[model samples]
Target: MLAVSRSVTRARIAARLPIVERTTAGRPTPTRTTKERTMPQHPKGSVLEFDLRGTGSGVLQEVAIAGSEHAVRAEGHPAFGGTDSAPSPLDLVLSAYVSCNQVTATIVALGQGITLGAFEGRVQAELDNSVLVFGAEGDGTFQRLTLTVDLETELDDAAFDAFVAEVARRCPLTQLFERAGVEITNAWTNRALARV
Candidate 1:
């Protein structure tokens, strides 16, 4: 596990940057704790915030969160006239979905007394780019999402099946896709694979 913290304070907002505001009325966002043998407890509610500054070329942008010393660059896809130096926003979305599933699965495994050898998830999506790129008249979104997970463990088939079922049901990313009307195909391989 990894500890994640955030503080809501004034960040340096340079001139000419467009800022989006989201208001929440509740407790401060909870900090995530890591390195414990058990999974971290979930917060009832949390407030997340972030900022992005355009890089002034090819739809590129630099992203950061409050209190973070590092930032990541994002850019539009090359097909849309971007330089393709960094990942497109849609790429980030798919990556986040897979990454979130990996973390959530690990936590579920730890809680279920399952000793995991290795695990990996790959996510891919098909998008209807006409709306964003060619000015089509329908909603621009993913037409389908495919998630494949390779997992290694010593548990019996029944136990592994149960574990996978629980993880699939509890993974927040899966629910997000469902809520967004994106069709998802989930495949699991309960065997070892080359580790990256």
Candidate 2:
């Protein structure tokens, strides 16, 4: 019995394990630890919870986050029997993606002691709505996504590329979309920062 228990423990230790860490936004992320370990170690991290409340009526939906007074509204297109008063769900998602990238970039720049100015981003996505409209037997996710970012900074081309790579690697939304099998294309343009 002691030998069997030791063998099981050794096998478990040889397997790859995930280490959960917290991001600056208080979100938990699973990352790969060392390749080999001697013993199992537990993480002493606190979990953060985010709650959202939403109300929908006639193709119009309003959502509010917990502990926040601000709310956002979304509506379907007029062709979909909606009043078209607000942006569609996909539009909101794209907006969030773009903003999240910018936010991540800012955080990375601050950590690296880099200065930035006049940042802008544009995103386009190709999606098939047949699954939602006709209940087709296919995925309803975006087929392809392209994001272009324009930043005014003093960093050289090589440094700019490295910075963008780091931002993409650290951005949670980018990770989520890529893991979901979305084909993403990102282009970054750097310009000289204006001197005051």
Residue-pair clashes per candidate, as listed?
Answer: 0, 0
lDDT of 1 at 190: 82
Candidate 2 vs. true structure, TM-score: 0.74
Model 1 segments beyond 4 Å from truth? 1-58, 192-196
Model 2 stretches with alpha carbons more than 4 Å out: 1-48
Cα lDDT of all candidates, in order? 0.68, 0.76
Instruction: Judge candidate 1 against the unseen true structure and give its global Cα lDDT, from 0 to 1.
Output: 0.68
Candidate 2's residue-wise lDDT over 69-173, tens digit each? 778898986667777689987888999999999878876777677778778899999988798788899888898999999988879999999999999998988
Which residue pairs clash in candidate 1? Answer: none
TM-score of each: 0.68, 0.74
> Model 1 over residues 1-196: C-alpha lDDT tens digits?
2211122112321222343343348444333324422342554323333544444454888777445466778888898767889898888888988888776766676556555666677987899899988999986878899999887776677877788778778788788788878898888778742344
lDDT value, candidate 2, whole model: 0.76
